[model samples]
Target: MFSFIIRRVLLVIPTFLAIAFLTFVAIRLVPGDPVEARTGERGISPERLAHFRHELGLDQPVWKQFLDYLWQIAHGDFGTSISTQTPILTEFTTLFPATLELAICAMLFATILGIPAGVIAATRRGTFVDYTLMGAALTGFSMPIFWWGLLLILFFSVDLGWTPVSGRIDLLYYFEPVTGFMLIDSWLSGQEGAFSSAVSHLILPTIVLGTIPLATIARMTRSAMLEILGEDYVRTARAKGLSPFRVVGIHALRNALIPVVTVIGLQVGALMAGAVLTEYIFSWPGIGSWLIESIQRRDYPVLQGGILLVSGIVIVINILVDLLYGVLNPRIRHAR
Candidate 1:
């Protein structure tokens, strides 16, 4: 298990390098010049442009710039945002909690409901319940996030007036963000209706963000459960006259969770990707919105650093998930 964990941790180095390099190259390949974009119309003089480029180290050769970027990151410096003049790391930390909160809520929403739904579907295979649940999962998987978000907003927010249109909380509640997670902070603030308001604001965004993950998790769970249920132990447990719940839940579900856990971990990336669209639609104040604003202004440092940071987070999560495989199924560690 220790060796397996070490291997996974070591693998992150190369993975991070690859992601960082690709993000660096890809952002540079985009047409807009950050300096020019920041300056906007009524362009600066040629000398001034040259100075700006040099100041940003853009005048350096691509190889040198890449090396410098690597060196800076190695030293824990993500560099100051070209647009904000603030350290990228500082801005990321400030905004990350919101994204973290949303992602957590979304994943919780998916896992809480998806697992049971999948179990039911698999247990009742070939029945109407199975078909209906599977169909809903397929529809959810197929839905475009932006379109789904709008549809929900129109119905729930616009017409029925059940939820707020955007933002993390109602403007009426103003208090210092103790934890940056509105739900927790609201409760901590002891402000009347603050916690409820935060929950209400989170509802639509969580649903929109969680839909695909829920679908994926549910389908994966069903597949895993189906296979596990067919195992000899499952039949043996049933033949032994164990309760149906014990046969399925304890024996089958535990063994089945290995693959389902992997799917859930992979969903972190999906949740983050989906958060961009959901945040934009709901005007949620998270890193997704921050990244969008940076992109509009062609903020290269923020774009590159932000993407690298996000990728690092995803890679770390995947590593943790890989380690969890050992705990779920001891055979995985033994095999390694």
Candidate 2:
């Protein structure tokens, strides 16, 4: 596992360069110039624009700028945001953890709910229980995460007064921004007030982001479970007087989880991608919301840095999932 992880890490270096190179070229290919975007109409004159260009190294050749940026990245600098003039790495580092927390929570909710729901549907095939679970999963799949978030807020918060509308905590509670995750800090500090507010605030967004993954997991789980249940081992288990519950849960569920894990991993990557909309809706201080603002302002450094960061995360998670496949299913390991 250690050697495998090291190999994956080594591979990501070239992957990063390739993604960065393509992204840099693609963004620059867009019609508007960042310099003009900065100056705006009736703004700075040509001389000032020229000075700004020199200051930002925009006067340099494109390849030179790209190579310079890569060099800086190698040295742990992500450059300053074009609009804000703040270090892109600092800004992103502060914001990303919040999004990470939200994504992790959503993934957990999806796994906790989706897999079991799928298994239930599979085990109870052709029954009302099966239909109801699958029906719910289908509906969940159809709903967009942002739309789902708004509906949840409207119904649960406004109409029902069940949960908070936005943000990560009650304004009244006012938990310190330790670790950028209110729920985590609340638990870490053992403060009931903070914990309650954090959990309550997380309710709507978590459910919203969790819905699609739940649907995907449920469908995969059902399919995998059905296939596993039909395997001869399952038949033999039943023939050996194993209870239906054990036959399905113990005998089939673990094996079925291999593919389900992959689905969940891909879902996690999607959740991070979707988080931009989710954070914007919820007014959460996360990378997605920040990235959107950067793009809107043509903040080149921030945009590129954020995209690379997300790409790296998605890539890492996928590699982790691949390694887990070997760990879970010994056939692959033995074949190796």
Candidate 3:
């Protein structure tokens, strides 16, 4: 198990470098100059433009710039944002808690409901319950994040007025964010209706963000459970006069979870990607919105560093998931 973990951790170095290089090059390839973006509408003199370029090191060759970038990253400097002048790491830490909170809520929403839904669908394979649940999952998986988010806002916010149209919490409740997570901070504030307001604000965004993950997890769980149910051990458990719940839940579900957990881990990337659209639509103050603003302004440092950090997080999570595989199924560690 230790060796398996070490190998996975070792693999992250090359993967991180590849991601950093690709993100550096790809953002640069996009049309628009950061200097031009900064001096929008008013424009600048040729000498001024040259000075800005030189100051930003854009006057250097691409290879040199990349090497400098690598060196800066190696020294734990993500560089100041060309547009905001704020350190990328500082901005990310400030905003990331909001994204983390939203992502956690969305994943919890998906996992809490999706696992049971999948279990029921698999257990009643040929029944109407299976068909209905699977159909719903398919529909959810196929829905576009932007469209779904809008429809939800229109219905819940506009027509019914059941939820806030956008933002993390009500503007009426102003308090220092000790944790940066609105739900927890609001509760800690001890103001009337603060926590409830936070929850209300989160509802539509969470549902929209969680929909795809929920569908994917449900389908994967169902598939794994179905396969596990037919395994010899499951049948043996049943033959040994164990209860149906123990046969399926204890025996089949445990093995089924190996693949389900993998799918769940893979969903982190999807959730982050989806958060961009979800945050835009809902106006959530998270990393997704921050990245979008940076892109619009052609903030190269923020774009490159933000993407690199996000990718690093995803890579770390996936490595943790791989380690979890050894815990969930001892055979995986033994095989390694």
TM-score of each: 0.97, 0.93, 0.97
Q: Scored by CA lDDT, what does every candidate get?
A: 0.92, 0.86, 0.92
**Runs in model 3 lying further than 4 Å from the true structure:** none
Q: Put down candidate 1 lDDT per residue, 1-336, tens digits, no spaces.
A: 677668878878998899888878887888878988978888899999999899888999988999999999999999998877999999999999999999999999999989989999999999999999999999999999999999999999999999999999999999998889999999999989999999999999999999999999999999999999999999999999999999989999999889999999899998899998899999998899999998888888898899989988988888888788877898877787
Q: Write the per-residue lDDT of candidate 2 for residues 126-220, one digit (tens) a residue.
A: 99999999999999999987788888889999999999888887776655667877777887767668788889888778888788888999999
Scanning candidate 3 in windows of ten residues, the lowest lDDT window is 1-10
Q: Candidates sorted by lDDT, descending order?
A: 3, 1, 2
Model 3 clash count equals 0
- Between prediction 2 and prediction 3, the one with superior TM-score is 3
Candidate 2: worst 10 consecutive residues by lDDT? 169-178
Tens-digit lDDT string for candidate 3 (1-336): 677678878888898899889988987888877999878889899999999899989999999999999999999999998877899999999999999999999999999999989999999998999999999999999999999999998998999999999999988999998999999999999999999999999999999999999999999999999999989999999999999999988999999999999999999999999998899999999999999999888898898899988888888888888888888998877787
Candidate 1 is scored at a TM of 0.97
